[model samples]
Target: MSSISLPLGGDVRKTRQNSLTLLINRFGVFFMILVLSGVGLIVSPGFFSSTNLLNILNAVSYLGIVAAGIAFVIFCGQYGDMSAPMTMAISGVISVEFMRYGLVPAFLAAMATGLVIGAVNGYIVGKFRANAIIWTLAMNFILEGLVRWSYKGTQIYPDMATEKTYQTGFFLPLLAKLDRHIMDIDLVSRAQAFNGLATTYPLGVPLVLYVMFAVMIIGYIVMSKTTFGNQLRVVGSSYEVGRMSGINATGTVMKAFMMSSLFASIAGIFMTSLNRVGAFYIGQGYDFQAVTAIILGGMSLSGGRGSMIGVFGGVFTLGLISNILTLVGIGTFTQKMITGFLFIVVVAVNARSLRKLGRDYA
Candidate 1:
């Protein structure tokens, strides 16, 4: 009877306040996308075309795949993976070389190569406790050197002629008879529509875009709907806490790196498919691009928070900006400068938000 009613405490209030704060924090990236879209549409007429829109999607497709995969690693609190581009290039080269055997064989071989590279990244970063940035950078240099030495600084072009001939032998008749129109509209009748529309499959766009989309979706599901994803989040939040929770922190980080490398390799394959060529320098600086897309998607650089959808949005935004600049006939240097500036701005905003979150949590 002497036990009095418990009072509502400050800690409870603080917890409620933080919950609201976190909800708002998560929306910053999405809001930024809306704001950018509005500004872009208002400023540029060319930004809204079906063709231009498809082009943006096509252009962003491979990068989006890479960014989606790497977003997990960043979310896992790894500093960065510099070996992404290298992994891509190596996989591309392997895929091109294996094409002489057959498409299926070639693709499988390329994926295998990617897996190996991913394993290597994971081993170094996880087992050795190496600095992610430095380790990945060194691995990148090694890969580049190997590629350069093997190719003697030359580019390897996929045998499109052979590919066409093979297609003609097997797929030509089927493709020729396929319906092109969608809903009686000629807009989706084009080859590009196969990238998303359910009608006729475009020879190149279908394979590349569909693969990229599939990868993105899978990555999204893995990061958001799985036990592994939860483990990654915990590890990213704090290695010490994660370890105390009986999660293998190093293993989680390694898995993230592996996934990142695997995605990069897939991106490389798409690039080769699109370009019909593999260059030693292919995917140059794409690691940074992936990082930029991840950050712009609203992922915290400090780690443990991001989504595949956000990465896709960020990739779309970047592609839109780049395409608009090109359509306007902006010079290469000017476009790079503008893009770089925008990247800096977006990243700065995200960084500020992350800092605020840390302070609030503290």
Candidate 2:
């Protein structure tokens, strides 16, 4: 009899608490960010300084851009493109080499090549339902070997300071004056633009930071507001269900892959410009780095859940850790170890949560 009367609204109160817990769990990246920021401040007073923050943003912007692209594939339920790093590597190398022709041509060539690679990956994966990770890994190795062979196992140093001297007039006299004028203005101006890709600071902010944020904003809009985004979400959730609902699942996934490729290539250009060189190793570890960022950003490995804001949080979190570690004198090797450790922990937790929900951890 005493137990027969329950408190009024107790179930409602429990529901409210559950909702709060879910929100906390879902947005835990931001909370971790706050915690990490506090830790950074405690460890290094300069962690939040304008100069240091700008450096952090600059350092992570390339990865952030790459991560934003790879997130699309993750969103589409593709594990990831293992070839992303190589996409960046080859694209950067090509851009630098193409500069001999002209900067505009170089930029176009880099972007075009990246899209071609992405289109191939998307088509093969979508048409055959092949294992995306394995296929892309193979592609990565193949591209690596080609790059090494092409460059004779050396890094391609960009000629940022000089353009290739042209030999005109003798071979083609009719076009001499126009060619001379065209080549003269064309090479230097576009090269300046190319260098500015990474160097220009809008209001003392690295141009790459602006680019990274812009990509994130566009990505968010595409994923949240558009019809294709809706289809992508449905397809990501369940390909069969999406197909049944008249969605072009394969095409949708293909676009995601292409977007990822384009993003990687973009990162490649900036990174190459920053380093002033391109080589097989230019983007060596970006593949897993991007996935880690997206995953830690509150996205599930199995796909169909994430946000650009969450991805940005994840990217900043990694950079913050690096800056803090550097302030505390941790070297790059140790930093890698710490990062790899964190990645393992996050994936494990994600898998556990998925298991609890009786979901596939694909």
Candidate 3:
């Protein structure tokens, strides 16, 4: 009698699905990037020229920094930071306004602003268990209102003079050094070397682009190579499990929030320098957009998975889409709509892929 060989049909199907998903996960974004680049070249002449490519990188550079920080928060299973836009705007304002003291001082002050905000956010959310989404939204609104009120609904320019009569008397002299021409717009303009942060192109590469790359690389190292990164992944997987494992779950969460805020502040500072002005409205739409980028990069909103490289791809994809759309004469508002639609589609595809791998929605 001869024996017939048999195969487990279900196992074979699952093996095939697992391989498919793995392949998609590894190369899908780059493949899409290539496709989008092709579309750009077809639709927009010279879209991939060195100058224009640099332009795309520069345009998304600050936002990429913001997304890098937000990625940590998402990886830790917390919601996105809504206060990021304001963090960037306010920090930039601080940098520009404090430039009279010196570049180092102004930069430090801007950093301090971010540090304080991030600390407060971390403590409140991580310790008190405040809802991250609502709390961050509140912070965002509070910052927006405070900035608007303080500036009297006007933009703060490096060269713009402060009102001396009413409110300026108190703080201006307190912060300004003993110089008669401290209020002189020309002197202030000359002093604001901070603009170099955004303007300087090293080796013909935009400084902000370098900053983005640096931040992303650091984040990658932290997440992939550090013990803290491992702890963060454990915490993201399950806070209770993390606690059981003797991890500082609260501190880990706090650090994640702080990281996000700090990154946003950096982006904010550069953006302000680029515009040569600081306004509450600066960096608007960054929070949602950053979240979108994180999701697009293959990070689960439920946390415990993602890579900085993937996050950058997500950021680059968005920039590519925007460039291609612009080349095809798509209006800004319509581009937003199209991007929104794309976001939904990508999210759905990611979810489907995960399901095929026999994973839950987390």
Q: How far in Å is the alpha carbon of 71 misplaced in model 1?
A: 0.9
Per-residue lDDT over 1-362 for candidate 1, one digit per residue giving the tens place of the 0 to 100 score? 43565655523333233765576566556676677667667767666767767778877777887887788888888867888888888888777655544557666877788878877888777767788889889999999988777666767655333223222222222433462321232322221321122222466454557877898899989998999999998888777789899998878887898788888888887666655566667788788888887777767777777778878877877787777677667886897687678778866766675555543220
Instruction: Please provide TM-scores, in order, for all candidate models, with all chains considered together.
Output: 0.79, 0.85, 0.89
User: After superposition, which runs of candidate 3 have C-alpha atoms over 4 Å from their true positions?
Assistant: 1-17, 162-173, 176-186, 189-192
Query: What is the per-residue lDDT of model 3 for residues 216-272, given as tens digits with 9 covering 90 to 100?
Result: 999999999999999989988777898789998889988898889889988998899
Q: Taking the tens digit of each residue's C-alpha lDDT, what string does model 2 give over 170-283? A: 111233434555334454555556666788877989888999999999999998789988887888888789888998877888898899999999899888887777778888
Indicate which candidate wins on lDDT. Answer: 3
lDDT of each: 0.71, 0.81, 0.82
Q: Name the better of 1 and 3 by TM-score.
A: 3
Of the two candidates 2 and 3, the one with more favorable TM-score, higher being better, is: 3
Candidate 1 residue spans exceeding 4 A from truth: 1-24, 160-206, 359-362
Ranking by lDDT: 3, 2, 1
lDDT of 2: 0.81
Estimate the TM-score for candidate 2. 0.85
Candidate 2 vs candidate 3: the lDDT winner is 3
Question: Which residue pairs show backbone clashes in model 1?
Answer: none
Leading candidate by TM-score: 3
